[model samples]
Target: MKQRIITAVVALLFFIPLVAIGGMPLQLLAAAMAGVGVYELFNMKGLEIKSLEGVLAILASVLLVLPKATWFNFLPDTVTNITLFYLIVMFILMVPVFSKNSYTFDDAAFPVLVSLYVGFGFQNFILARESGVTVLMFALLVVWSTDIGAYFCGMKFGKNKLAPHISPNKTIEGALGGVICAVVVALVYLLVWPMANYNLLIMLPLTAIFSVVGQMGDLVQSAYKRHYGVKDSGNILPGHGGILDRFDSLLFVFPLMHLVGIF
Candidate 1:
């Protein structure tokens, strides 16, 4: 816990300035995030997509994010474009070979999932930058509130399990508190940041909805770790485990916020 706090401080140390500056710095940040996400993803599935296939997937993910960096007028809306990309990738996965006994179909799912997940999630960071740094700040706040609220509320009042199969520790009381914290954070930020032209009602409930989804995101990662019988995604970010470990919730939030046009 202490290590996570220190790591977050270090992250803010670098993250705040890059995001504030926008342009290449933010774009570089997005690229690095995309790289880490792709690495973790391909590793997670245990599907060995290597050589040309791996490079192609990584290249596609970067290209998927580049449009978000530039203020390109022709770039499609972030949410629909990303979600659609996921569908396109899924379709790519369905392509069959001359024989079902062949290894081709077995390998198809990895690159597709990596391309879509890393591509979509990382690109949305650019959308976050569109609304200024405060938008990113609020996204962080919503996720943080959910984490903290769930911890305290679960300790104090939890009885029912949220999903015993996926995340045994998560509880219904914790989920409720997490949502409430998300809504309160949205409301408070709206009151404080008069310059941010966000729709408070939309932002508030969306925070709650995304917070729940974020919890699911965390559970998804936890499931991955459990599946692999490993601890942490990687040690890339000390004290925080890995890039995915820290920003697992952000994956869900960035795309969801884009869907609601919050950024």
Candidate 2:
């Protein structure tokens, strides 16, 4: 618990600044996160990171997440997107044909999937950040509130397991508590940051939906870890495990917000 608190505080201190700065800083942050997250995911599959495939996978993942970044300002958006997509596709397709021993179809597929997962996830995150810092911050706060609320609520009042196979720790009562807590946080944010211009009626349902999605994201990651027979994604964040462990909910929440036209 102590380690978890310290890790969260340190993460907030570092992340808040990048989020506040926005633009390239946030893009770079997302890129770095995608890189590390892809590495950790590949590691789970027992893949070697020093290999050519690993390097390209990480780079492709980072590039996919850097759509809003200024690094490619010289190129047109369409061109940049196409070039990156071509590069990633070529690498994935060619590797299996050229390097049959070291890289197989399974190996090739992992990078592509990882790229799409982390890339698309962080791309939506960057989109949210580009929309406005306030919108991004609200999305983040609601996810955190749901997590906190569920943890305490589960510990205190949980009686039935929500999903015994996927996530034994979660409870139906805890899920309800998380939704309630997220709604309260959204309401508070609306009051304080009225400039967000959230319709109270719309915001309430949005908050509840996001909270549920966030929890689903958590459960999905948990299932992944369980399938691989691993405890945490990585030891990068000490108590938090890895970038994936910390940002799973954030990844899912932002995309959902985009779909709902909130971002």
Candidate 3:
């Protein structure tokens, strides 16, 4: 518990400043996170970090994230998007040609998927921040509220399991508690940022929806680790686990915000 609190504080110290800057610093942080996340995923699959496919996977992950940096603002969005896609396709093609069976279809495909998953997910963070600090901070705070609400609520009143096989700690009551908590936080934020222009009725459902999505993202990462026969993703953050473990819900929220045109 002490370690967790300490780590959270340390992270906030670094994260708050990067978020305030809202540009290349944040993008570089995102790239570093994606790199570590891809490495952890590869580690789970028993792959060498320095292997041909592994290096490509990490590099691709970093590259895919770079286009979102503030420096790349000069380029058209269409150009950047297409270029990354083309490069990813070429990377996949080159895998089989350069090294037969050293990297299988699944092996090659995994990194690309991770690149899209982690890379584009964080890219959306930059997009969200660019829209407004309030938008980004609101999304983050809501997710955090959901997690905290669910933990305490579940510990006190949980009964029925939310998903026993995937995450035994979660409960249906806790899930409800989490959604309600997120809605409350959203209301509070809107009250403070009164010019938000979002109706309470609409905000309630949106918060509830994203709260559920955030929980689903947690379950997905849990399932991933279970499939790989592991517990935590890595020990980088001590009690907090790895980049993926910490950002799983955040990752899901970012893309969803984009889908809903919030950013």
Candidate 4:
């Protein structure tokens, strides 16, 4: 518990400032985080990070994470980020042929899918920050409130399992508690810094929906970790696991926010 708190403080100290700055620095941080997340996913499958597939996956994710302004300056406008990403995907798929089937198509599938998942997630993260610090912080607050609410509520009032197989510790009651907490926190945040375009009645329900989506994201991560037979994603953060572990909910929430026209 002490270690967890310490790590959280240290991380927030480093992360909050970058998030506040919100430019190339934040974009670079997001890209680097996406790369680390790709590394963790590769490690879960027992793939070497130095391997061809791993490098390609990391590169693809970084490319996705970076904004157009940064990359377009160097590359021709004809070659969009999506084009580069698809090219990388093709290269990853072709690795099995050169390796004489030592690296199977099945092996290639993991990195390809992982790159898309982690890549798009972090890409939207940068998009959220670019929208405004308030917008990004609103999303972060919802995710964090849900997590904290679920943990305490599960310990105090939990009687039914939410998904016993994927995450035994989570409870249905706790999930509801999390949604409620998220709505409340979101309400408070908006009241203090209300957006001109936001409708309070509509936003409140949206907050609850986002909270549920964020929990689903956490469950997805838990399911993958269970399949990999690991306790945490990685030990990058002594008590918080890896970048993926900490940002799983945010990853889901941020992208969904964009899709829903929040950003």
User: lDDT tens string, model 3, 1-263?
Assistant: 99999999998999999999877788788889988998988888787878766777777777666763344567676667547555765777588777867667766777778767877777677778888899899889889999999998998899999999998888999988998899899889877864254666777788889999999989999999999998988889888999999889988998898897676
Ranking by lDDT: 4, 2, 3, 1
* Residue 115 accuracy (lDDT) in model 4: 92
lDDT of each: 0.75, 0.85, 0.82, 0.91
Model 4 TM-score is 0.97
Clash pairs (backbone) in predicted model 2: none
Which candidate leads in TM-score?
Answer: 4
Worst lDDT 10-window in candidate 3: 63-72
Q: After superposition, how far is residue 244 of candidate 1 from its true place, in Å?
A: 1.3
Worst 10 residues of 2 by lDDT: 77-86
Who is ahead in TM-score, 1 or 3? 3
Off by over 4 Å in 4: none
Candidate 3: stretches off by over 4 Å: 72-78, 194-197
**Which of 1 and 4 is the better model by lDDT?**
4
